[model samples]
Target: MAGIGPLTQDWEPVVIRKKAPTAAAKKDEKAVNAARRMGADIDTIKKFNAATNKAASSSTSLNTKKLDDETENLTHERVPTELKKNIMQARMNKKLTQGQLAQMINEKPQIIQEYESGKAIPNQQIIVKLERALGVKLRGKK
Candidate 1:
């Protein structure tokens, strides 16, 4: 008893209260209420809110489309063999090297090589330019 210290007691429970709204928040709420009372139509606000919600939801969604192998292969179509043959024969008849033909057509030499090898992706503009430069009917009916 002589060596014992003062006993500690539990404190009384204190009531907790939610924080009051800030001045700005109260002003904004008053303004919205006043606008509603003054017959301000909420349709525009509703539309804007709906649009934002829709855009947000769509942005978070992932594109999960399945691609077909055959369609994927067909998408990157190359120049036809007949077209390649015509380009090569025309170039030879014109006595112009690949570089010379490319320069004459205002294109790169690699482009000319790709066209002749049938590995190039067909471009109507490039074909037209080649036809004009070489005076050969490379593409079209027969």
Candidate 2:
């Protein structure tokens, strides 16, 4: 007992609270409550929520699948000669010079020319960007 020091007392638990909702969230809640009071049906709200959730889930799944497929297919796939010709023709039809089309696709004009002339095969990323910019499909099954 003489060698023993003072015993430490147990500490009380501390509770932390989160901050109140922001003004924007409060305003949104008020608007939603007003809409509900104005006879917006509960069933309609439920359906809208369900649809939004479904769309978000589906989009996430689709993007994940697309990314996985792209990663698995990184090996250079040959492009058809006809597709190259068609891509060139489409660019010409849009009255866009090679440089302009390259700018639109965020690529160099020489790369575009090489792709069109079948001198070089483009990576999948470039192909996707070109498809989006040109509004045409340049790659096919290999």
Candidate 3:
């Protein structure tokens, strides 16, 4: 009562106490104690843990066998040299540059370049688009 006035009052700061151990932590501690009572070597467990951590650290290493398999799976039949020549000739006859032809077909110029250079994998949809744009047979029997 003496610490309070019309415009003043006393306040105590809050104290934070340490939390009690969680159930999982208590269970792990009990297991460790039981293992010690059973004469299980703590040193061997420590060594095994260290070995596991070391193996995990080195697990980022690349497996070249899997990489080779992936690359092999990615292999595709490239556009034929004759097809490349025909595309170039047709584009030249139409007076359309690679960029222009790509624009006409709504494709990136790199696609046209890839087709002309014989490095493109044959896709039926793109081939059909190119045929319609260039008015030429680019695939199968011509």
| Deviation (Å) of 35 in candidate 2 | 99
Write model 1 residue lDDT over 1-142, tens digit each, in one string.
7999999998999899998867997887788888999999754243455545676666555332233223545468899999999999999999999999999989999999999998899999999999999998998764
Q: State, as a TM-score between 0 and 1, how close model 3 is to the true structure.
A: 0.54
List ranges where model 3 is wrong by over 4 Å. Answer: 1-47, 50-52, 55-77
**lDDT, candidate 3, 1-142, per-residue tens:** 7987688656988899998867997888888889999999765243465545667555544465556557446568999888898889989989999999999999999999999998898888888899999999976676
Question: What are the TM-scores, per candidate, against the unseen true structure?
Answer: 0.50, 0.41, 0.54
Tell me the lDDT of model 2 at 4.
94
Greater-lDDT candidate between 1 and 2: 1
111, model 2: CA deviation in Å? 0.3
Residue 133 shift from truth in candidate 1, angstroms? 1.0
Q: Candidate 3 at 140: error in angstroms?
A: 1.8
A best-first ranking of the candidates according to their TM-score comes to 3, 1, 2
Model 3: number of backbone collisions:
0
Model 2 stretches astray by more than 4 angstroms: 1-78
C-alpha positional error of residue 60 in candidate 1 after TM-score superposition, expressed in Å: 11
